[model samples]
Target: MPIAATPLRVLQVTDLHLKTQPGSRVWGVDVDAGLSAVLARIRERHPVVDFILVTGDLVGDEPDAYERVRQALEPLGAPVHCLPGNHDFPAALGQRLRDGLVRWQRHVIVGNWQFVLLDSSFPGTPSGHLAPSELGLLDTALAMHPELHAMVCLHHNPIPTDTPWLDTMTVGNGEALFAVLDRYPQVRAVVWGHIHAEFSARRGDIHLLATPATCVQFKPGTAEPQVDELPPGYRWFELHPDGRLETGVERVEPARMPASARRAPT
Candidate 1:
């Protein structure tokens, strides 16, 4: 197999919690303003991105927000992949995003890497689970792409965050998900969003990453929904053809704020 000529850089932005209009607040943070700033920072910091993975919580249960999401994100000029979060209106989101700018894709193969997007969301709840079909899809995708390094993306954290309250909302079938992944050595990483903070763990060679939300971040290791002082942020991953990975989290600095918090038309 030919090695990729260049490393693949992916941007992961999550827990947008967008409202139907701009300047709306979630946990006291302007999410619309937050997302826009994160995107602008992404553009300025990393001019070239291979693909973007939004790990759920795209909206605050508003289907109307998906259109605004498309508009806010389209300027990045890269293929965007979305997964549903517990707060999303899945049906309306699918209908509204059927056209162009942003998209909902499950599996993608790029630059010797297989990117698998999972739907761990369960309607009307904050917990997550993988239906039998989704598990099968993962198995099949890995079987088909044994030649490519695999990175799994989903909405819920699959491992314990050591905080009792947040751990209750972890993927209900995380053990099952890991069972499938353990069978495939090509799987290198699993990433997600929802806890609204940064977390990293490792099991041998596999990396487990939980990114901070684009809006208000939760106080890490807290027992409840306490917002933290961390600025709005996004995660970047550089996947080398040799299966080595480099990633980091970046937040829009208050000094170099990308956009004003003033209301913009949704």
Candidate 2:
């Protein structure tokens, strides 16, 4: 196979959950400060990324909270694309985004890559599911972009999380999801949020990645609900001109008042 050539850089953020009121805390952490802190980290590391992908759960359903989150991202210097999570407000999202904002099941093609962002929010549930409309949309988009390697981003994990607790509420029609994905060999990766924990695995050629929350990460495989104290983080994907993607997570402490880490000797 001949190697394709065009570089693409993508930064993914998940589970910001910023509250509408400033200074409000989500899961014991000040969300407003957390949003700022995470953005600071992104700017420091990815000054000029090709694009930013917000995986979902931006504001914990406050509707107004998205303003704060969007404002924080304003200076990131790239096109910001988002998807909805189980905790996100679909109505608010629709209102806030521009008329041209890519709809729930649109195909965004850049260079040799096509990113398909899906909405997995179940109307009245903490968990998620892919409605028939969404599945059909995804099917059409993948078919149209068959020439480009794809990255599917959604709020829910379409694969088992193994934490029996979470596994129960994961994407309800995942097998159906995988069934569709199986038809598209050009899909190189599947990235999601919602789990809040950090995980990476592979099913055949498609790599799967889960990012840590902007405020917190859930403990992996725990029988009980738990939040990890590690600071918020993001992931960077460098898509080679030849269709191969090099990726890894970039984590930084949420900005601190006096700076938490011990300083070097003066």
Candidate 3:
């Protein structure tokens, strides 16, 4: 495959879990602060981020958290496309980002790649299921962009993490999801957020990647839902025009919090 004039650069920041309030803590870490630190590292290291893929859990259940998320991401100066996680309120999130710099869009094309974002969030449930509409979108998008390398993004993992408890939440209809992709040779990657850690694997010609959360990190390949002691992190991707790509996970230390600011909620 010949290289295009420019490689598409993307930063995947997921499971932000930002609280409506700045100093709120989750699992003993100040998540809002953690997310800020991750963004700082991205800005300093990757000065020219073409796009940011926010895979969901942007907040807990706060209706106002979307606005806060939008505010925090404004400094990145890149278009952000978001998908909903089980913890997110899509309608509320859409309202805040509907007409802003952080809007959630379905299909985006950069260089020789076509990005298709899908909503896999199932209301009132931790497990995910891709609705038929999403399935149709995936089918149509791949059909429409046969000449472009396609990367499909969703909030839930389509393949099991193999970490017993976490696997329970993998996309319930993952087989169905795969069936759609199996027909499209143009699909090169499947990316998601939810497991809260980095995962990289391949299925045939497709890359399966899960990015680390911008907040607390989750211990991988465990029997249960476990929080790792690692600091906050994010993933970066460099897509070449020749259907080849490079990606890596980067973690940043949390900013120093005052003693009083370090307490977890009761």
lDDT of 1 by residue, 20-115 (tens): 778878655777778878888888988888889998988887788898888888889998899888888778767877657588778889879999
Candidate 3: what lDDT?
0.84
Candidate 2 residues 1-94, lDDT tens each?
A: 3343556888888888877788866656666676677788888877878788888888776888777766777677678888888777787787
Q: lDDT scores for all predictions?
A: 0.84, 0.76, 0.84
Candidate 3 clashing pairs, residues 3+ apart or interchain:
none
Q: Select the stronger candidate by lDDT from 2 and 3.
A: 3
Q: Considering summed lDDT, which 10 consecutive residues are worst modelled in model 1? A: 257-266
> In terms of lDDT, which candidate is stronger, 1 or 2?
1
Model 1 whole-model lDDT (C-alpha atoms): 0.84
Cα RMSDs of all predictions? 4.2, 6.2, 3.6
TM-scores for candidates 1 onward, in order: 0.93, 0.90, 0.93
Q: Model 3 over residues 73-148: C-alpha lDDT tens digits?
A: 9889988888788888889877777876788788888878999999998888888999999999989989987999
Better of 2 and 3 by TM-score: 3
